[model samples]
Target: MILQGNDPTTGASFTLGNRLQRQLWQCVWLCLFRPSPRPLHAWRAALLRLFGARLGPHVHIYPGVKIWAPWQLSVGGHSGVADGVTLYNMAPIEIGAYCVVSQGAHLCTGSHDYNSANFQLVAHPIVLASHVWICAEAFVSPGVSLAEGAVVAPRSVVTRSLRTPWTVYAGIPARPISTRTRHGTAPD
Candidate 1:
């Protein structure tokens, strides 16, 4: 939740409970989640589920991935979040079925309002529709939603929502480069 009147620069942006939970999660992540073998996707998924994350069957979340809050994350069936991906979900982040988030991709749901004198904390949810693919090193900004079958090219930055399904986006501020042809089996 965005702290409407709180000054992020001087005061705490999140509740005490929230801060404690994150600290505990960090310990677990360092000890249990980070050192696991790469093939142990199910093990990591179980750890995430234990923290209240809603993950569907066969979702492969690599051990190297960093999730700010697992409880605020949800991944649909057969989706894969590759190694080095950072899910900074201050708010909820939802990844639809059959999606792929490649290595080094960052999905951020929190930011500070630059215009505010106190640097107010702000947050919004990020949504990746079914069959969406975020290529390696892509940066998805807060509140951005990618349509079904939308693909973000490697190293691209997405500041706005990608409304066109089956489209491929590229460049710094990602723009539609080509319309992709969708072909994929339904997640069981």
Candidate 2:
């Protein structure tokens, strides 16, 4: 589905330019210096901001995080998007306050339209609500939403809507593993 609020031409340009810039920066950093935990965060954030990323207060973006378009990323206050996380957002990617996108998680907000002869591109928005945790190696596909406090376990492939709050989702094409408190306690 064509996502609303994204102009096709503008989105294309943004995607292309942002990808090139990110790649250049990545190469430079990797070649020149090793990925150190210290100083990289500030440096990366500056680069992202230069590319028009709408980052809110105290957002901690670790090294090795790949963002397709900084202009397409909208991170709310105090969010932590960890290392090796890839945000392939051809459209908008909105991460709400205090969300934790753990290491190696992929948030893909764009895909190719297979039905068309030319293989037209299609993009969608990904929304993650406050306090959500996308665990390591989890994949959140186009247009998916992780409700507030939802937890996606490691290596889970989330291919559908996750509307339940404070629930644990696990496995490939993730299903609700259980409904429980944030600490994994059974609900009373």
Candidate 3:
């Protein structure tokens, strides 16, 4: 897919670069002022929007939710990014409608190339499908996908893809813990 907010070929553009700088400024504001919960949350979301975050309707992002670059983050309708969640999105991060990113969760979207002489950087996108629940303290590494209706339990570290719908995933380098309906009932 064409990664939103980035030129797939050149991977760089003046507009995108300027937006990235603006996002960093917003992060600085968040770190310095430490505004109250409600207003802070709203302001931060607004800042993200200003920098090209294509958030659909009713996206709630709490204060203490850190985003590396707004240009790299997109949230679909009715999504919730909870407090203390950090999105290290040096690359694109796409969240589908109704996704819930719980408190303290981390979505890391970039890494350094250890073999490179200058330790060059590399980035990959993280995609979360509709109705996914990333539980509190969970981490999603770069290039991972959490498919629709997938529930990642608290403290889980997801390194691989979770493609099946309505599956529960837990533990470090998260694995499927169980499978159930969206309402939590096991399928017959």
Candidate 4:
């Protein structure tokens, strides 16, 4: 769950970049990405790039996916975000080439500081290196970076950065379950 700074329930407590920019984006998203079909990945990527996202070649963004701020999202070439993915990128969320973000996954770059009385908004960047796969329904916490070739099992919750690449992780607060090996020049 996220404690959004721009939450209507919280009133105007945090900044969502510029008001004019956000308004413009809302219009574009509503008319373009939101209503577009799932196969229109190229169109979605182009729209996101036009809004300041550093999208690489062949980045596939599904129509059902929701990106809070396109400018704060970056995806490398051949990386695909499956349907039902949510990018709550209050900060930056960078994904390297050849990575796949599965359906129902949430890449959240923002969180609330529970210790604070105001539940102050805290943000951190999320980086997913090349050949990484975050399985369905996984929750990637703020500031967590997944190294190259890492596999986050379905429904896993990653709360910390995993420096070791080519490993399989599972369970809540995901931990390394085993080392993954690639098969014949492709990812494991």
TM-score against native, each model: 0.96, 0.78, 0.80, 0.89
On TM-score, the stronger of 1 and 2 is: 1
> Please, what are the lDDT tens digits per residue for candidate 4 over residues 1-188?
23454544556555444555777888888898889987888899889989999987888888888888888888988899998999988789999999999999999998778877667778899999999999999999999999999999999999999999889999998999999887643432
Q: Where's the lowest-lDDT run of ten residues in candidate 2? A: 1-10
TM-score of 4: 0.89
Q: What is each predicted model's overall lDDT from 0 to 1?
A: 0.93, 0.79, 0.80, 0.87
Over the stretch 31-99, how does candidate 2's per-residue lDDT look in tens digits?
A: 532365655666667667877788877788876677776778999878888878998887899998888
Q: 9-68 in candidate 3: lDDT tens per residue?
A: 466433555666855767665664246456465566676787778898778887667777
Sorted by lDDT (best first), the order is 1, 4, 3, 2
Residue 92 Cα positional deviation in candidate 4, in Å, after optimal superposition: 0.2
For model 1, where is the 10-residue window of minimal lDDT?
Answer: 179-188
- Candidate 2 vs candidate 4: which has greater lDDT? 4
Candidate 4 weakest ten by summed lDDT:
1-10
